[model samples]
Structure formats: structure tokens, C-alpha cells
Target chain A: MSIAEKLNTYTTGPDEQGHFGRFGGRFVAETLMPLILEVERAYTDARRDPAFKRELEHYAAHYVGRPSPLYFAERLSEALGGAKVYFKRDELNHTGSHKINNCLGQILLAKRMGKTRIIAETGAGQHGVAVATVCARFDLPCVVYMGETDIERQQPNVFRMRLLGAEVKPVTSGTGTLKDAMNEALRDWVANVEDTFYIIGTVAGPHPYPMMVRDFQSVIGQETRTQMLEAEGRLPDSLVACIGGGSNAMGLFYPFLDEPEVRIVGVEAAGKGVETGEHAASLNGGRPGVLHGNRTYLLQTDDGQIVDAYSISAGLDYPGIGPEHSWLKEAGRVEYVSATDAEALEGFKLCTRTEGIIPALEPAHALAHVAKLAPTLPKDHLLVMNLCGRGDKDVFAVAKRLGADIE
Target chain B: MSDAAVATHLAQTRLEKRFADLKAAGRAGLVTYLTAGDPDAATSLEILQGLPAAGADVIEIGMPFSDPMADGPAIQAASLRALNAGMTLAKTLDLVAAFRQADREAPVVLMGYYNPIYSMGVEAFLARAVEVGVDGLIVVDLPPEEDRELCAPARAAGLHWIRLATPTTDDARLPRVLAEVSGFLYYVSVMGITGTKSATREHVAEAVARLRRHTDTPIAVGFGIKTAEAVREVGAVADAAVVGSALVERVRANLDEAGKARPGLADDVLGFVRELAGGLTA
Candidate 1:
């Protein structure tokens, strides 16, 4: 059966309550329930409104520089010596990442809802930069919660966000990373629900957020479908994208979910290695548990305390993946894999040298997997990987890692 | 009745009697909350044991989770302090068990996120909680929609499964929330996290009046009842004025620079609790 045909038989969850097969729900304090419901209602209406769609499309085309190009990685593919690899150049988008796609949609929704304040959480700071850019464009006050540790490492993006008029609040709790940043953001949203719109940077969080974010980001897949047809004359044999909170991967994978012939692979950051007990491969290393308003695969201890996830790429340093990805993995619809920091670094260098694209470490993890899988596949096999972000923000960190002195 | 059912009935009765006594006294009851093992387990235990005598009618023990999104900076810091001091779910229940040994009548509710309880396994946690003499639970993340996951089993295990209702819980949704709820309903007075802003007395009165129409369960208003003045105002309308962040803030303030319990830290926290409880009758 075709992927579309098979999807038709399966339930397209989250049921009425935002659950992707008991994975996603409004697992929040009662104080935030009404606000979440309000967001859900506004988004549901906005989805049907042509004006909203038009506004989003206008911004996507003019502001975000979409639809991003689909380019054949001739050198990289030849180097791999198997599959013909293509690059979905989302890294070229405004704010240098795919994060702006969802931010633009959500910022528009926030305006429609009359929200005066925009808040977000960032790890690698791409989402923080995207949110800050949108807020500046709309003249809304933006506050970004980032971990203290991340703020120091992703300093370039931190300066970028502040330059865009965002107050970058450093979170100091619980290993001071993406999960803590998210917790702080959720806390802020609960406290300032009166005039705030929390632009969650990924396809995680409670109801409406996962569904709404997926819808907004599905633009990636939608564009890729058409662009791939224009380039390859048919669907690519496989799809690959990196998973943090799984937004970029979800954005790229949503439209192709039912395409049974098109294989989908999600790459997670393995840090040193999954077996080393320091990785962000939630699907590979973690189990199903509830955190940050959704039940998904989380890196948690036996006693249910969340374990700190490590990744050289700050974006992939989250403890949990999006609930849809969890469901997808459980149903065996999407294959999940992992790439270590060293492997991802190799992928980053390979893409830079071969394709002349300095990809962000997040998608470098995907490239690492692509590098491995492409070699094993036949030369006739087609593979498209989402180069989700650029590496300009990661230069300093990468330089430090490579023992290169850059003044 | 089954042993579990009987235990649940007793717990329900205990909670009801406290509220009834407050009603007869022409004032509200005080529900004081603090994170277990804050600063240190011994200091936290001392504070827990002292709450009732300090004028607390019931106690809500925060089971510190690594991620507490429902809380503001104060409670979040408290959880961090507890966790940093090596506090665990098992230790939290142990503290409660110690408290229960001396004072068995005060309704103690384990309040926090669900992962800890879930990690311990639902049945196992419930059995442990029951064995430890925990009277009720207020799992913030578990909603009425997810009653089957923990609420149903918690109730079946003979514990009062308290649910939180907020200003956003409209008349339409209140029924579902109140359906399986056994103990008093915790009404979050403000539309924010703990320790942010207090709801006006008029708003609390209106909310309490609305909640009264739906269920006869005692309503305890919390999530911003910080000051004695705010406590007094909330107490006038609701059956209980739940003070969490304000009391936890006391625990935070009374600590030394190194976050160790200073001399009379427990007394200092209990003294503040007394002042907040005094607002109930004032």
C-alpha cells in the first residue's frame, strides 16, 4: 500500500485532547489550561482562515526566503559512493535555521490573539534568534529563556537575539540546559498568561502546540514534496533530518508521513555515545515519560528524575523528543537513529568541504547518519537530508573543539 | 468495604471534619505547603512536624521533581535545594511517615509532577504512600482527562485524589474535574504559577461561589496567597487558604548563605506559618 493509503487506515492523532496515542496532552497546571485552550481555539480558527494563511505565506516567501532550494550534493554523494544525496537547504533561510518557519506562524497567531509579549526557550539559540527576529518584525516584546551554560557556548546567537531586542534570561536550574530553559518559559507563560504568547521552539509541549507547530512547519515537507518532484521527477527514496525537540524533523517528515515508499530517518545526538551514558538519543536511550506537558520518550532515571542530555550541538541537547515522533517510533512508521559528537563533527566538515555548506551541528548529526547509510545503499537510491541550520553560530565552539585559534 | 475503600473513607472523613470545624469556627482552615527535604531532610522534617501546632490545619508536601514547570522561582529554587541536598521521592515519603508517627490527624497531600510517582510505578507508589500514611495527593500534571493513569488508581488505593480548578475551568468543564475528585478541590486563585500574583477577594469570592454550585467539596484557594492580608481575604470565601510559596520563601530566607539550615530555621518557618494561619481567624 502507498504511504498515504496506509495513513488513511491509521488514526491521525492527537485525539480531541491533544494526545498522540497517550503521548501528548495538557499535562500542565490548571492555571495554564484555559490559556492553552485559548491558543488551541485561535489556532484552529486561524488554520481555516484564508487571510491567516495568506499572511503566513507572504512572510514565508518574502521574509523567511522559502521555499528553500533542493540541491544535489554531487561531491558529497560521489564521496559516499552509494546513494545520490540531495540537500534540502533550510540552512539558507532567514535566521539561518528552519526555526523561523514555526516562529513566523506562531508570531502571526500571537498577533491575531492580541498577545503583547512573546516568550521562547532556546538551547542552541536558533529558536531564540528566530523568535527574536519575528518579535522585532511585529514590534512585540520578546523574552528568551536560555540555559546559562548554553548562553556562554552559543554567545554569537545570544548577541544576535539581544540585537533583535530580546531579553535573554539565563536559566540556572537543573543542569541549566534546554529542558530547564523550557521549564522557565512554561513558568513565565503561566505567570504572564494575560498578555503573553509562548512560542515553543519545537513540536513538543501540550495540546495545540504540537499540532499547531507541526502544521506551521509542515511547510518544509510541503515545499520539499514539490521541489523534489521538480528536481528528481519523483519522490526521493529516503528522508533524513535531525531531531531535537524534533521540530525540524517533524516539519520535514509530516507531509511525507503516508508515503510508504519514502523511507524516513531521524537522527539524534549521541553526545560521546549512547552507551557512554551521555547522549540525547531519547528514543534510543530513554523511555516513555511525562515532562513539559507531553508524554514522550525522555532521558530520565529509574526513579523518574530527568537526566541531563549531552550533545555538542546545543539544539539537540533536549531530554525529550516531540510526542508525534514518539508515536511514530512506537508504530514503526519512522526509523530513529543516533550520531555521536565526533561523527557529527565529521559530517559537518564533510558537508563544508564537499558541498560547501557549513551546516549546523544539529543537522550535522543527520548528515553523519546519511554519511554512514549512503555508503551502504546502491548508487541509484535517492536520499534527501534537511540541512536545517547554518554553522555560523557554531564557529566559535567548533574552533575551540578543533583546537584552532580564531581571534 | 475493602481495606482500600475503608482507608479512603477515613481520609475523606478526616478532611471533611477539618473543614467542618473551620465552618463551625466561622473561619477558613490553613493549608501550608513546603518542599520536603528543603535545605536538608532533618530541617524539613522538623518544619513538617511543627506545621499543625503552628496553626496549620492540613499540610501539603511538595515531592520535588527535577522539572517543576507549575512553580515560580521560589518553589523551583526550593526543589533545586532539596534535590541538591540529595532529596528523593523515597526520602519525601519517609519524611511524611515520620510526621505521621507523631501527628496522624492532619491531612498530608503529596504535591508535584507525575514522573516521580510514575517512575516508582503507580501501584508501588500508591502502596508506599498508603503505608506511609499519606492522606491525599495533588499531582499537578495529571488532569481529569487522565484519571485512568493515576487518579483512578490513587482513589482505588484509598487516598484522596485532590484536583485543582482554576479561573479558566468554566462551568462546563468543572463537572468533569469534580467527578472523580474525593478530597477538597484546590482552586488556584490566580491565573499564574505559584508565588506570582494574588487574586482579588472579589474574584476569589466569585470563583468560590461558582465552584460551590458545582460540588459540595471543600474548596482550598492557593497559588498566590502569600501575605497574611491575602490569606485573610482568601479565607473569608474559601474553606482553606493554601499558602505554599510564602511559606517556602520563609524556608529559603531562614537558610544560611551556604543553604544549610541556620539555627531556629524550623521555628522561623513555623512562626511565619502561624502568622498566615492567624489570618484565617483575624
Candidate 2:
């Protein structure tokens, strides 16, 4: 490769061993290795086939309500009084978030691999709802493992999953959150490896998964790049997105990684605050370690015991981030920051009041960062923030937090 | 059997010697697994010291971590109990060192996830493990694909790199699973976590037979065997019977309401170990 090509980090990555430098690799039990390899092989073949692309495009346009509008947030930019802001508007997607983008792609791969059963782990229930939607479309049996705590808070999505003929199992293990849910899902996959395809709802799992999920979700950036150019005749000066296991953020950041001029910022959820040591900000407070398959930044003890992360946003309430995000954070390709629960609430309210868009609490963290960073930038600076999810599912929790009277 | 090559490289390990002694005695072996500091450190140490006399031909000391993902509820709880009682990787090694001082012949293996050892640095951890009289290492997370990380270095340090081949390990993947594998080949009897489900004798026998085609290392069948009957069933086919969750579950059952070890807990656990060992003799 030429020096210029070598300078571009995007040309190739996460080499055959599934490592993005040292962050991403297939550090799974032997029981799951063969299955993971099968998934990788099927996905590789599907990527090379034209029919797979056609099928995904067909579903994206007609079923998932693709190309979710890139709305120029005039009032939000006015309120910030600095950069011209644009919202990616992924909240308008059929499943009400950016999750379906990858869910749709994986369900198609599962079908190609002759996998008849679908199992997924979900935290905020958006991924569960999306997985259920795809399973319903493809006529496959779906089981979603959700923490009992998440089931209590995300009752509506649980009901939605059941209505779509998917069984929702409550994981009652340690802390009863995303981390526990992932453990339970992995257990199920190992026990039922014959026909089951575990659609890990993030870019965090062992190899092929981080890269495959990133590829599946890259449409977010691909579309954003086209729309930004169509709208402004140039790429946005900066891009921002919230991260849990970092699928949405990876999707938005992948296309721009080679564009040296486009600054990328990832918002991590600082539950109370990073200083308080109660945050879900792995890149901010945690160190590099292995969990849920890949080696990434994790909240762990000196003895390597995983500690539960605290966050008001169940979606971002994870103990670790995606391996690629870990790589990017270390590679200096992405600036990682955090937003407190109180600041996320403020961002939620600002988006609702100013732009008349209610974002899921997960993406509110990104907006919280934007509310801080946008005001400091010059007015001519173009900035894009992924509005990853709709707040319809979060109204009950938000109302309770706001101390509002409910009938 | 496919043990010719691996036996030559790993024959010097304490584990190889223990299995060889068992073979000379014309009996299948009982490999017992106990957490390093379950309930507390005192009773744990006693159980560790008494296992060989109680009929255990090999001992696997679980190095407890925060999340034992590949383990079932029984072993998972065992890990948490050990961690809650202040068990660290260093402390686990200390427990092994203490056990090794008294019993020089019992093969001692340290089993758990990789993060703790990784946190301690692989080279440093490998040196410490060898120094602590650790014979083998069973890291559930490290497959052969990740050999450069720990397997190669550990093997070079004369510590056996024990590999686990599960029901999912097909013929194509078995060779890779056996590569650089020393000590013994642990065949996880079921396709699930430790202690949750048991495989049929037919399944265990068939798996062991298939694995015998790949490597000559002694094959220990684990995952579901609990009682003497289960142990005898496994001993009938495999070279050794590994009972973990059952032993840890016994520890849990003997604990007081406050999760402390009851009086006579060590003797009670040893009695159970003798009962399990009786199956191998039969």
C-alpha cells in the first residue's frame, strides 16, 4: 500500500483474526467458536452476493422506513447560539430507533445460514422490539433475554415483543441489567447452538460480530454522508453520537474515520458522574479488559471482577463499550466524553422544547454533549448528532423523573 | 490414541505423572474441583489439603472471578462466595502454595477466566503460577486462536495448557483445540455451562472415543456428573471424572444461614469426595 493509503485507517481493519489492533478479537469459549465462524462465513458470502444487498435495500425502503430524514434543527441551533446543527433523525425509523438497521441485516444473514431460531439480549428493549419485528417478518421463533429490572422498566417493549410472538425471558442474575442479560443470552446460545443465531444488539461481542455489526449499521453514516453533502455541499465539520455497546456510534463514525477533517465525538453516559465512580463511561473511567467476548474498556475491580455500571438510560447502562470504540479511543480517532443523568434530562427537555423531537434517553446523552459543545463552536461550523431513538417508550420513566402527575 | 506427540511434550508435567500413576494402578481417576476461598479461607484450605487422601487423583482449584460466564449457577455462586470472602488471584496462588508444601504428588490446576491473570500481566502471572506449584491452567476464554496471548508463554514456562473440547467441537476444529494442549484434554460432557446439564453415557463415551483419535492426553469428562453413580458412569469410558458444581454445591449446602462454612465442613466435604472416588475403584 502507498503512504497515503497507509495514512487512511479505513482501507482495512480488524484483520482476519477479528482484531482492531489489540482491542477486538474472538476471545470466546470453544463451544461458540465454530458457530461464530459459521456466522462469519455466511455473512462474508452474503456480503459478496448481490441478492443480499437487494433484499436489504428492499426491506430498508419499504419495511423499516429507511433514509430517515436529515432534519436541520433550526431552533436547536438557535438555542445553542453557535454551530448549525443537524439531527440524523434515526428515531423516525420503523422500530423507533437505529437498532433495526443492524437487526434487519442480521436476520437476513440468519435466514441465509439456515438458522431457524433467533435469540437476542436487550437492555432498553429497543433492540428486543426490533429483533422481534424482524423475526415476525421472517417467520422465525425469537427469544429475547432481558434483565428482570429492565423488564420492569421497559414493560411496553416487553409487551410489544410478546405481541410479535417472541418470548421474553427475564434474567435475574447479578445486577439484573444489560450485562446480566448478555450473560443469559450467551448461555442460551451455547446450550442451543444447533439452530440458534444470537443477534447481539451491539458491536461489542467477539470478533466478526463487532466488524459485522459495524458493517450492517454503516448505512447510517453512508446515508448521512450523502444527505450532508446534498444539504450543505460538504461534510459536517463534526459528528456526534451516544454509545452503549456503541453500534449506532460505530455506524455513524465508520464512514468518516478516513476523513481527517471530520471530528468525531462519542458520548458516554455518566450516570451520576465519572468522579463519583457510578458512571457507564468505560472510556472515561474504566480501563482495557476483556468482557462479553472482546477486550475493551471495562469497569472492573483490581481482581478483574466486572462491576455493574449505573446509568439512567438503560440502553447506555453497560459496563463496557464496543471493541472498535475502545480502539478508536486509544487510536485518537474519536474524542470520548460523558454526560450526567441530570444533563441528559436537560438535553431531553431541550430537544423536546426547541426542535419538537423527543429523543430516547440514550441519545439524549449525545444531545447533552452537543448542548455544551455546539455553543462553543463558531456559527458557520456544521455539526451532526445522531438522534438515535424516539422517546415514546421512555415517557413513563421520564414523567416519573420529572415528578409529573400521571393518571 | 492421538496422545503420542502431546504426551512427549507434556509428560514432564505433574498432571501427566498423576495420570500415569492412576493408569499404573489400573483405575480411572477422580479429578475434584473446589474454589480456592469459598465461604472462607480456612475451610477451603482444609478441603484442598484433604482431597488426595479422600480419593481425588487430581485437584482443580478454581480461581474465582467476578463473572464466571461459562459456569452454571452452582459454580457461579461458588465464585461469588469466594470473591465476597476476599479471594484474589494472588491469594488463590498462596492457597496452592500452602497445599503444595504438604502434598507434593497431587496435581494442582488453576482454572478460571483470563482477565485476572491478564490484569497481573501474562509473563508475571505465568512465572507466579509455576512458582506456586501450579501444574496446569484451564482458561475457559482462551481458545487456540489466542495462543500467543497466554498458551504459548505458559507452555514455555512448563505449565500445562489444558484445553476444553465441548460437544460443539467438531472433527474439523478438534485438531486446533488439541494444538499446544498439554496436561489433559477436558471434554465438557454437555453443550452448556458447568453443572447445568448432564450428557448421556453414550454421548460421553462417543466423545471420548472421537477425541482419542486426535490426542493421547488423558480425557477428563466434566459438566454434569454429580453423584457416585454419575462418576462411575463417566469413569467407565473416560480416563478421569471431573466433578465441580457438585463439590461446590456441597460446600454451599453445608454453609450456615450467613453463608459461612458450618462446623465439620472439611470432613463432610472429604467424605463426599471419598464417596465419589469409590466409583473409580469400582
Candidate 3:
């Protein structure tokens, strides 16, 4: 049988009970089970309604600036002297990141459900700014829970969220990072279940969220497929994206899963190095465990205590990855790799100088791997990477790290 | 039967006897909860040993976890304090064993998240807990759907597997909650975490009445029954009133500026438990 035939025969899952090969399930509190089930029901109905699709499409084109360009990196491709490289420019979206896609979908669902309040948790604050922007557009009250440490480091995005009318609640527990912020948001949702809707930032959380966020963000791959076929008259040889809960990667990978010719690669943040025990590469340095409502690969101690994860980029400093990524890793459909902070910094600078595109540190991890692979492949090999966010919000931290004087 | 089986049977009998005694007294039971090693191990043990004498019919000893998502700031801080003082699951079991040596009549229940127990390996933790006389468990993160993970094994070991039901638990979902529930059903009075808003007396009475129709199990109301008046109100309708955060808060208030236990820390905490129990009987 042909490779495409064999791959096409593989069934897509997360069967009726929401188990993506024993990874994703509803492991939340009993109080949250009902609310989560309600969300699943609403999403199921919204997915089937044509009007909901049309309304989502309307906002995608006008509000979020959809069909983000598929730009060929001519200078970087020439410098690599091997593969031709292209970028799926999702960073050009209105909120300056790919986060606005999922936020728009969820806030629309919240409006449909008649929920009056919205709550979210953010690490780098991109998702916070996106959700806050949507809430402002819809005129809903918004509250964002951010770790105190993250609030200090990502001050520009924090200011953006407040300017867009979001109340940022600082969580000061358990290393004060992404995980603690999520815990606080869950606690808040449990308390105010009547009027509030939780807008999860990634392809994590319980049932329907992993599926819903991926479905919303899959516009990236859909556009890329059309644009690639239009530009090269054929599919790309490989695809690359960074994983922090794996939403952006999932968005770009879901559409091409059955295309056997496409090689999918997920890059993880190795803060210092994987051997240093300080990185956030769950697939590389962690084991399967239950946390934050799903079973996934987590950076935890032998005693099941969650360990603090480190990354120069606040966005990638999470201990757990999306459960679907765990399933994909086990199935061997996607190759999971890690890039250290130093390598990411190199990628950041190379992209800025060669392509004239200042990429966020999260996607710089992906670019780092692309830099490594592009030099090894043949000249005609085509590669596509998701530039998931812009770098304007990261200037201060990048400057401080590089010891550059912005003034 | 093996000696393990015999030990399990005795633990079950002790829990059954405590509930029966409460029924015989015609007054609601006072279930006092405190972190096992908050501040330090010695002060926690002193407080645990003094609970029964201070009128606590049943005690819930919190197994400190790094992440307690269902808890509010007060219990979260309590867990942090215990963890900072070098407490582990092994040390928590040791604390229970020490308390059992001093008091044999009062039933002790270990309450917390499930990861620590999972980390210890379920069978070994159950055996050790039964040996140390832990009569029941309330793993807040494990629900009825995942009962096969710990609840079934815990019940098979003859330990009472207590479950929690909230206001969100409707008629359709109540049976799943009551299906594997062994000892008593913990009815979370408020929809929030521990140490938050209080539930009204009318709501508690109504919820208990609804739960009684489903099972013969006793219902214990917890979460936000803080003051003596609130305990009295909850005790009027439920079989027991479980006070956790209020007792933990008392411990926090009595600590020195540096967070060390004051000279009369245990006495003061037990004194507050006594007042809550007094309210139950009033």
C-alpha cells in the first residue's frame, strides 16, 4: 500500500468519552464536571450550526485579519544553502499573536451561552491581551489571572491587557507561574459558575477545550495548504511549530495529519538545557501525570510533586503539554524535539537580520530547529514554520538578555 | 482472613461506631479538620491528640500537597507552611501513627489531593494507613468516575472512602456520587473553595434532605461553616458539620510573628474546636 493510503486509514480519535488514546479526559473536581459538560454540549451544537460558522468566518476575516500571508524567507533560505523556507505569518493578527483566533471563537461562544463575565489565565500575557480585546469588543467584563512573577516580566503585555479593560489578578502561589495562574482561574470559575465563562488559553484543559481550541486555530494550516499549493503547486516537505501546551503546533498539524508526505516537528523550550533539570520540555524530560484536568506529560518529581519549569520566554515555561501532544508522541506521528535558550536567541537574531521579521521567543525555539535542519536538507526541500507571535512585546527582555542599550 | 484484613475490619468498625454514637446522642457530630504538620510536627501532633478531648467526634487530618486547587488562600497557606517545615507523605503517616498511640477512640480521616497517595503507591499507602488507624479518606481531586483508581482499593482495604457532593450535583448526577460512597457524603455547602462565603441554613437543610432521599449514608456539611453560629446553623440540619479552615485559621492567628507556634498554640486551637462543638450541641 502507498504511504498516503496507510496514513489515511488511521482513524482520528478522542472518541465519545474524550479519550485521545488514554491521555485526555475530564479529571476535574465534581463541581466542575457539570460546567465542562455544558461547554462540550454548547460547542457540539455550535460546530453543527451553519450560522455559527458564518459568524466565525466573518470575524476571522475582518476582526482578526485572517489569511495571514505565506511569505517565503528568500534571504534565510539562501544563507542556509540547503532548503527553501517559508513562514505562516500568524503574528500579523490583530492582537499581535495567534492567540486571537481561539479567543474570538471562545468569546463568541460565551456570548451565545449568555454568559456575562469572562475569565482567563495567561503567562506571557498574549492570550490575556487577546481575550481582553475580544471582551472589550463584545462589552463583557473580563478578569485575567497571571502569576506575580509573570506580571513583572511581561509588563508590556500586562499594560496592554489593562488598556483593553481587563482586571489582572496576580497569583502568588507555587513558584508564581502559569500553573498557579491556571489553578487560581479554576478556583474562581468553581465559585462563580452562574455568570462566568472560562476562556482557556491553549489546547489543554478538560474535554472539548483541547478539541475546540485546535479547531479554532486550524485556520492557520487551512490557509497554509491553499497558499502553499498556490505558490509551489505542491505540498511542503516539512512543518515546524513550537509547543507550550501545544496549541499553535496542533493548529498547524491537525490539517496535515493524514498527508503522509508531510513531516511534522514540535519544538519544546529547553530553558538552559535538558540535562540541567531546569527546562520546560515535557516530552523530553517529563513523565505522564494528571494535572489541571487532563492526563499529559508533566515535569514532576518522583513523588508526584510538580516541579517549577524554567524558560527565558515566559510563554513556554509551563510544566505540562496538551494531552493530544502526548497521544501524538506515543503514536509516533509527530517528532518532538527541544531547543535551548541560547539556540533560541540565535534563531531570534538570525530571523531578525536575515528575514527582517522579529519573531517572538516562543517561535524562535521552532526557528532554532529549522536553522539546524535547513542546513542539512537538499536545496529543493521545502519547509514551513508557524511564526505564531510578533516580537514587539519581547524587546525589553531580549535587550536585557543581549545587553543591548535600547536608548 | 489475613492480619491486614482484620486490621481493616477494625478500622471500619471504629468509623461505624462513631457515626452510631452521634445518632444515639441526638446531636450533630463536630468533625474538626487541621493540617497534619502545619507550622511544625510537634505542635500539629499536640493539636491532633487534644481534638477528641475538646469534643471533636471525628478528625480530618490534611495531607499537605504543593498544589491544592480546590482550596482557598487559608488552606493553601497552611499546606505551604507544612511543606516548608519538611513534611512529606511518610512524615504525615508518622504523625497519624503518633496521634493513634495517644487516642484510640476518635476516628481519624486523612484529607487532601490524590497525587501524594499516587506517589506513595496505592496499596502500600492503604496498608500503612490501616496499620496506623486512619479510618477514612477524602481525596478531593478524585471523583466518582475515577473511583477505580483509589476508591475501590481503599474500600477493599476496609477504609471508608468518603466522597464530596456540591450544590452543582443535580438529581441526574447524585446517584453516581452516592454509588461508591462508603462512610458519609461530604456536602460542600457553598459552591466555592474552603474559607469562602457561608451557605444559608435553609440551603443546607434542603440539600441534606435531597441527599437523604438517595442513600442511607450520613451527610456531613462543610466549606464555610466558620463561626460558632454558622456551625450551629449547619448542625441543625446535617448529621455533622466539618470545620477545616476556621480551625486552620485559628492556628495561623496564634502563631508568632515569625510563624512559629506560640506556647499555647495547641490549647488555643483545641479551645476554638471546643467552641464549635459547643455550637453543634446547642
lDDT of each: 0.90, 0.91, 0.90
Per-prediction TM-score to the true structure, in the order listed = 0.94, 0.97, 0.95
The pairs that clash in candidate 1 are A3-A258, A3-A260, A4-A258
Clashing pairs in 2: B2-B215, B2-B216, B3-B215, B3-B216
Q: Residue A79 error for model 2, in Å?
A: 0.7
- Looking at candidate 1 chain B, the ten consecutive residues that score lowest on lDDT are B1-10
Ranking by DockQ: 2, 1, 3
Maximum-lDDT candidate: 2
Task: Please give, for residues A295-379, the per-residue lDDT of candidate 2 as tens digits.
Answer: 9999988878898998999999999999889888877778999999999999999999998899999999999999999999999
- Write down the lDDT that model 1 would get: 0.90
**Which interface RMSD values do the candidates have, in the order shown?**
1.4, 0.9, 1.3
Error of 3 at A47 (Å): 1.0
Query: Candidate 2 — which residues are off by over 4 angstroms?
Result: A1-6, B1-11
Q: What tens digits encode model 2's per-residue C-alpha lDDT throughout B126-152?
A: 888888899999999898888898999
Winning model by TM-score: 2
Ten contiguous residues minimizing lDDT sum, candidate 1 chain A: A2-11
Give the per-residue lDDT of model 3 (tens digit) for B117-227: 877789999999999999999988777767877899999998998899999999999999989887788999888999988888899999999998898787899998888
DockQ preference between candidates 1 and 2, better one: 2
- Considering only chain B, report the TM-score of model 2: 0.96
DockQ of each: 0.69, 0.77, 0.60
